[model samples]
Target chain A: MTTLIAPVIPRSRLQRLRWTFADGGVIARGNLIHLVRNPSAILNLLLYPAVMVLLFGYVFGSAMNVAGGGDYREFLMPGMFAQTMTLGVMTTMIIVTNDAARGVTDRFRSMPISRSGVVLGRACADMVNSVLELAVLLGCGLAVGWSWHRGAGNALTALGLLLLLRFALIWVGIYLGLMLTPESASAAWMPLMPLTMLANTFVSPELMPGWMGAISEWNPLSATVAACRELFGNPGWGGDSWAAAHALPLAVAWPVALTLVFLPLSARRYRRLDR
Target chain B: MERMNSLAVVAEGVRKHYGGAPALDGFDLAVPEGTVCGLLGPNGAGKTTAVRVLTTLLRADAGRAVVAGFDVAARPAEVRYRIGLAGQNAAVDEILTGRENLEMWGRLYHLDAATARRRAGELLDRFGLAADAEKRVKHYSGGMRRRLDLAAAFVLAPSVLFLDEPTTGLDPRNRDEVWQAVRELAASGSTVLMTTQYLFEADQLAHQIAVIDAGRVIADGSPDELKSMVGGDQIDLVVRDAAGLAEAARVLAAAAGRDPVADPGARRLTAPVHDRIGALTEVVRELGERGIAVEDVALRRPTLDEVFLSLTGERTARAEEGGHGEEDRAA
Candidate 1:
């Protein structure tokens, strides 16, 4: 034990500290920058959301009556924000799976970096991507007569909530990204898109049938979509006002619970990669 | 020149099994400091498994390994901190540029911005990859990518470097380049443990050599010690007269009291003799006494291939085909 001690602090401790945050930050930033650097990724992140806004606004705007007395675009905006963040989760899975498949993750494993930092960095970057996607999608929403009647403070709170949702979904993506085989993440997890669509992103719970309406009303994503709607001045989507009263707690809880469930599981998958 | 330290790396009874088949079966090694240890084995002989254990990538099922004075299993992080591994594959990201790849690895080792940048530049220059440093690894040719991978392993200045089959797929020139780079790294006081199926690699780069077969070490020594194991020396002679083959064998056998083989088609005579000069003289005298003339006579030491063949009872070339050629059955 005495031999383990160094006259100067062993460099690895300092190195470990550097790797944990500084390196993870660099990797996270690099991954985001790499995404924006590629023209297609830029389009997928920016242009694709813009396209969704245009397509959905024209196609569904007139027929839909949002819970609130406003344009369908306004009701659709918050849900789309949640949807964008949720979609961003898949990128985390695709990128992590791709990295794992290409043996880059193994390279990181052999190095001195903290094991968790690899997935955390990617998750953080995906969160950023989700935020960007939400902002762009909202910008497009505003172009076509979507406006938030909620006060600036509440609007800011809504934006914060959207980002938080993205953050949570990033972990889910990271967890799923770490969990699924690279092949399955692309093939099997493609179904998550339809699953996302099944929720009340575009339709009202009143419009959805009995069982799905109940699912949409209580769905964790619906909770976020509802809270964002209330904050953004969209009409009431159904949630127990009792649950709505605990909105801040629920916002904090969804991410915390998902992270608690997924981060450790992601870490476990990472540890198993060593085997 | 730095004086050699005789305790560079040591492994004691290290064992690793993937599923049911044992990959490393109680393997052991000792590499003197500042010297190169070449690990030679057929595929699945546990060379890579031993490397993975030494580098702390895989835990050993049994036995102890101390690398750079850090216990591999007990103090894996410490072991990882001191050692660098260049796995069988290049392990470079095809998307990143050569310089970025090295920088990323440097960052993984926790080098600060300035240090990582500086080290990446130095490694690019050292590996002669400076020209292609800014190009994505995906664009680089195989040899360039391999050199960059080797450079990544060196950027951290680790005390113990493990190169697992460092030159598995390279042309002769590229292979020489990698070997030169490895030698330079060792010369700079990095203790290198390299595994290679190329017999000449052990003969060229290894200060010490360990021949592993069937997941166990069959031989460990300097190149000369290993060469001496099969037999210290041998004599080959050609007989001018076809009728002299039988007489040659009889005369050599009578003179040396050792079995001599006659290849009548090639008119060649071969035998293993303990004393080269004395045996040659006695054979000459006895063959003359038997009236058989020798066309040519030459003495030579055993090659490493011959040494491997003698120890494992199979040719090194054939062993490599059945051994080490199998895709790692690792989970």
Candidate 2:
């Protein structure tokens, strides 16, 4: 009532950009605080990697072959790392979808804040969450006797590649979240099941049927898993396929390509949403 | 003559479509500054769409809307700056505490951290949520969440506020709480446009009511003006059994002049009466003479529900239209 007039928005290009960052920072801080307040969500995140580690490292470790005869637990570590990244993407999608369905997105859209800031905030918040997930999975891997035989530099590169894949998946999640309802988005996320399985994350695709193996190799996820395996000095079949031939570059290329495709798409979908 | 700024919200021929079905078709309204306007309508009536368009959240396919002196589509950012919105759903973050939600909104509105914190505390106290400010919103009851949502909208005390079905799913006590907050907002000279299915809510809060049906404003006037248009008092009766519904309707039709509408679902009959006392007395005597079993009968003043029914029920502009909600117009 007292100050009914709208505050003057900074209109210059640089000021606008500053506002975008400021708004995104505020939203990101809110999301992080939300995470801190809910200890159970963090618990859920921990439980997922813990479950997968037990299933792969112990349950079927002896039966599975790790090509060059290395620790099965080490081989599964990167796979679990890749899988955790994909699950983190689902969490972002679910968060966006819930915000959309529950009207939080509309509330933000109606605000004077920068249009891109909403998504950028979610991405920032979720990237931090993904990092926490990777950390937990790494702890789980260590507990299961999985060690990165490669030097610290290579291990960090592997971690970077895993985060890059997650970053790409985050854009994909934002796009789908903006496009679909919470229920449909939950049911529609593919990477968690077929995509992860098809990728060399769990089983080296070379051992599967020819066509399935090809899909597994080409599954963008496979590149990251293979790249991680090589960097971590984990056992992996470096086959003659082009994807296997250039695992490191493919890990970089796939995420960049995926980001190029989905980043603009998510932004466009956001701008034209409810039109 | 009034200045342009005096008219807080204005819309001209707004239209929107979803697939083949037009959700909002040719809607128009003008609400003056500092007044409460209720966009009253039933389900699927495009009230939500109208609110979205005016709030700059959804674009209108045709026509222009001016909110607080800025064209909604052309100057959406400016409009957004001036308006507060509590969407149909309570959109608060479930994981954040009530206090955190307000502070977040404050910071987003460009308030400094210290100002944001102080303002958030003030709001929590004003909305009576100070006691539970530290509790996570996920654990808060439905009423608490809605109250927080409304408080978030007030972080800036915006000139224009849009509330789409603000109290739709709330219980009576919570509804009262929201209504009280809305009244305070309106009294503080903030223009408010709220949509609701509750006739009583519109009657209680809105100084001006726009009766919307089938995506169009069918009628617009003060509640009293609208009630007067329904002519006079109404006679309502509930039959003891469904079998007596037809007989009760026939007797009331002759006495009240207008044919009574029988809503068989509720075993109730209603007819507009010109001579209130005469019609009530005659109806009671006639039903008794005919041995009609009447469970209850009463004469009541015409409400906004009747006004709405009279406006929308008779036109049926869309043609496949039904009566106003559940009160079936089976004459």
Candidate 3:
């Protein structure tokens, strides 16, 4: 006990940031270690998108034609990227709920470490997983004759936008995970599939009925997909509708809006665990 | 630093409610430094709730508590920095290996990477989990997991430790192992506040026991003092003949200065007696004069189990119906 009584240094802003990252990194490492021990979950996540890409690009690509005279596989890659990133919400939700249910979150809360570290650590780990998922899907896209005709800078920017969308959705996952028990969080998986599929992930909204097209066009997932297509110079309708035309701004805005709503929500839920 | 503070934990009229029902109603306690205070109670007793509040996991709706010399509500981080809590459920991550679990906790406690690793190794060895340190916790048995959890708590050698029902589901052998570990912790001068449902556990480990029920401490004292509260030693006598039972009862009651409990089937009578030897001799003399044949007579002090039953029974009978039904089984 006496050995533990070291002087408490007054932390500067930079020091605090360093401490936060250090603590958050440790927690993130724990999350990553879980993934290593259970490689099946990561393999499933990686396999899900690859299979989706191959199935839609080869099986469905031959039949459907883009509004522009370009390959449908090229047109579908960006949408798959956006869809994979958004579906990360389910992965984050399940992991967070499991941690909370298993008392790991309580153990973290009881420690003297920063409260934000727990959430930030999960966010960081999920982002890393999202990056891996993107790489696997991109590899699958390349294997099926999909290429970004745009410059390297534009392609990288498109990847950046895809990851940004993932970053935003991770907050939503954290918020939902903390709000619901693990059993209820699994229920989120059902709604998420329809939510992503109803967007421009698998097919263009222009091909759908008028009313359904309008709804899909406004779907946040659609905005990121459209934005990625424009950056990658891939074939997309780029619908004349105002929402579709300004896809870049909406792609950024939707994630910002989601983070604004869910970050505080997740933080509040984490703090409320003490009560 | 005020290193010589006598009391490690102090609570004043702490109150907490879940929805409309009060979990802790005006609970008060004080535990001196370097001592093990066993909070003895039954299921649904506020033992877990009290430990949670004192450990800074939950806030009391009213009243105040100070643990490890820091106000629990006002300075929870400071309190957390000095204390360890192994909750009702084992809080270790099941996916991580036993060593990984402790090392993660150590890092969270702000120890450097090397120190954390070294401490994790030391704790695994201390808790006799060194061989299984590399195995994932999911594969660990209940006792092994519990030892790992306890080892995690000891990573910092905290000044104060709170263990809530640490051995609730353990078999006798595992329970004894935990008891040995707790004893070693106390011997090392770490104040321990453990909540337990087993009276014998408290008797074995606690220097002092606080019997709590209905969100309050119904009785608090040394084990012997609490037992004496229920009453002194009792003398039991069995007669040879059923026909002389009434005579034996009257003589025993007169000698003991109280009505003796009679079992007509066994022709036995039991009565509380302050002076064991004197009461025994007087009862034998009286029974002899009354021509009653006695088969067996012995005097024995009551066990802590009897003490706990008597104290909690009296409180539950008069308390409201709702307090005893809610299980505070939160992690």
**For all candidates, what are the clash counts?**
5, 0, 0
- Model 1: per-residue Cα lDDT at residue A21: 73
Task: Report the lDDT tens digits of candidate 3 across residue range B1-331.
Answer: 4233699999889999999888899998989999999998777779989988987878889998989888989988888778888888888888999999998888877778898888888888778889999999999887888888888887788889898888978877787788888887898889999998766677788988898887888888887787678787777788999998888888888888999988898787878888778888888888788888878877655444455556655434333322222121111
Instruction: Please provide, for model 1 over A154-258, each residue's C-alpha lDDT reduced to its tens digit, 9 standing for 90 to 100.
Output: 988888877877776666776777777878888745677766666667887667777877666555676677778778877655544454456556766786788
| Backbone clash pairs in model 3 (N, Cα, C under 3 Å; residues 3+ apart or in different chains), count | 0
| Candidate 3 residue spans exceeding 4 A from truth | A1-11, A58-71, B1-5, B230-309, B312-331
On DockQ, the candidate that comes out on top is: 2
The reply for model 2, stretches above 4 Å from the true place, is A1-8, A189-191, B1-5, B239-268, B273-294, B298-309, B313-331
lDDT of each: 0.74, 0.84, 0.82
Chain A, candidate 2, TM-score of: 0.95
Comparing 1 with 2 on lDDT, the higher-scoring candidate is 2
**Native contacts present in each candidate (fraction):** 0.36, 0.74, 0.54
TM-score of each: 0.75, 0.90, 0.83
Clashing pairs in 2: none
| Model 1 lDDT tens row, B231-311 | 655566778889888878877776556777667798987676677678777777777777777787766554445666789
